[model samples]
Target: MALCLLSPGQGSQSPDMLARLAADPATAGTLATLAPLAGDEALRVAADPARCFANRHAQPLLCLYALAVGAALSAEGVEAALVAGYSVGELAAYGLAGALPAAAVLRAAAARAQAMDDCAPADSGMLAVRGVAIGEIEALAAAHGVDVAICNGDEHAVLAGPQCALDALATTLAAQRGAHVVSLPIGVPAHSRWLQPAVAPFAATLAALPWQRGALPVLAGVSAEPVRAPERAVETLSRQLAATIDWARVLDVAVEMGTTVFFEVGPGNALARMARERHPGLPARALADFASVAGAAAWLRRQLA
Candidate 1:
């Protein structure tokens, strides 16, 4: 069976997210390699939601977690022919696909997070809205000075703008029937017009970096198309910072590409849940759901067989 690896973005992090992986001896080397990038007392930082929620800490930590999990699975001979990531997770996807080395991937992730954080105002944040039509959400966003950051599907999306505006939108949506809005812990208005200032610098940084073609195809988060060239990869990644992501389409592209089995190599099961919701028949599981890397690998091997 052809397998697709899914890397998750922000909003799924928790205090004990990486405890199981950290306890595994096989992940020692991978954790060591990522420790410096994750900062002093990395696990301590991860255990604190307030500190880890910052863009500076969250980006690198998420990338490290995904890379470590993927490495452990690979060691067990779980093969994924295709890969995709959501937002910041794309950097980890590049590393998983062999498009960037470990050092380079962490460096890029740090830089990307810093750049986006710089563009984000202290009062700006994101909100996830569901059970409301995209058109209605767009209308609300236009009325509230917020922008649609991501279109998860026809009736679900994430909005980004000033925190006050999001609060106002939430209040308004609360009044409407069948409308739901949840404020995300993140403070940055990522993937929105507010981050437009960060695009040029991030693109320049990617261009200056030494890049190698990846061994596996990575579906672009913005377009869901297979990106084989480093140039295209850089462009898509940079542009996505200020563009709305169509994640539903990305899932469709994965199925169209013959992905029968899926693995989410990250701290949470958000990606896997989304995939299963979109395609109930597809076999999808998250590494975080397993008690050990070996258990996850065995499950994958069973699916392939």
Candidate 2:
């Protein structure tokens, strides 16, 4: 039974995320490694709605969630034939794949957040637009001086630009057939051209780091294929910071690679939901879906059997 491991990016985090994980013995070791890296106010900020969305807090915390959950699953003897991630979650994916250590992954996530925050203009953000075709969304965003940052599927995309432009675009799309627009919690415009300045510095950071090709096949989010060599990790990680995300392709590639099941190893169920919707025949569940990592691990083992 081939399985795919998923790591979610930002916008999926909540206050109780860590607190819940802390209760699970299966995940304690993973959390212990992450707690110090997350800073003293990590748990407090997660519980504080106003502070959780701040890039500095959101990025590392989300990555920690992914790494911790993935670590727990590994500790329970579960393994994935393929691994993938969304945005900053990709850093955690590398850790899951054994390409980087958990500490290095968290540090890289912090740097990523800082770099993106520095380049992001004040009052700029991302918006989720459902029921609009990607092509149409791109056209509308271009007209509003924004960019289509994420293409989740044909009719779902995330647009990024200045707050004013996003508002204007949202208003225009609100009256369209089947259109539903919602402002995201993020303040920085991620995965858009606006973050291009962060690429070079992040590239240098990744390049300077030591890496190893792990046992599992890790898919590159941008290319939706195996990143076979450690040498390519730096370029792959850096370029995706400012490029558009093609998550639909990532799912398609997972199926092509013989993934019979999926485990979304992170805070929310968004990635699992999307996978099930796109490929109903395959079973997918988020780590949060179970009472504990032990429960999730046990269930997955049964499913494989």
Candidate 3:
């Protein structure tokens, strides 16, 4: 079976997200290398509910968590045929694909978070809206001065802008029958033109990194195209910082590429859930759902067998 690895973004983080990885001896070395790169307070922030979701802490920690899990799965001989990530998780996807070293991915994630924090306007954030038509969401976003950040599906999208504007849009959508809106914990209006200022600097940061074609192809979030070359990877990685992400297309293209199994390496299982929801007949599971890396690997092996 061809396997696709899914990496989740910020909203998937939880207080105890790293506990399992930290306790696994198989991943001890990876955590040792990445935790320091993430920050002196990385573990502390991860364990603190209030601070963990902050972009500065969340980005690197989530990338580090995904890399550590990917490493452990690799050690078990579980290989991915393709990989994709949502938002900040895309950095981890590069590392998982071997385009960048794991440590570099953590460092890049830190720099990315810092750049976004520096460029993003204060009090700006994201909101997930579902059960509403995409056109209606776009119209509401235009009316409320927000931008559509991500298109998760035909009816599910995420909007980003000043918190006040997001609140206004949320208020408008709340009145619609069968509509659902939730304010994300993210502090930056990621994947919107509001973050355009972050694009060049982060591009330079990615360009400076040592890169190589990896064992598998990574689907670009911005275009849903397979990225195999380093130059293209850098371009898409940076451009995605300020462009809308077509995650719905990414999922569609993964299926079209013959992905028979979807496994999420993550701090949470949101990506896996999305995959299963979008392709119910496909086998999909998240590392977070298993008690151990071995268990997850075994399940993946079973699917492939």
Which candidate's TM-score is highest? 3
lDDT of 2 by residue, 126-225 (tens): 9999887888888888989998887889889888889999998999998765689999999998888999999998888787766876457777877887
69-103, model 1: which lDDT tens digit per residue?
88888889987889999998987898888888777
RMSD of 2: 1.3
What are the candidates' C-alpha RMSDs?
1.3, 1.3, 1.1
lDDT of 3 by residue, 33-143 (tens): 778888888888899988998899999989989999999999999998899999988889989998898878988999999999999999999999999889988998999
Candidate 3: segments with Cα more than 4 A from true spot:
none
Model 2 lowest lDDT segment of ten: 208-217
Candidate 1 error regions (>4 Å): none
Model 2 TM? 0.96
For model 1, where is the 10-residue window of minimal lDDT?
A: 17-26
Q: lDDT (0-100) at residue 302 of candidate 3? A: 95
Count of clashing pairs, candidate 3? 0
> How does each model score on lDDT?
0.87, 0.86, 0.91
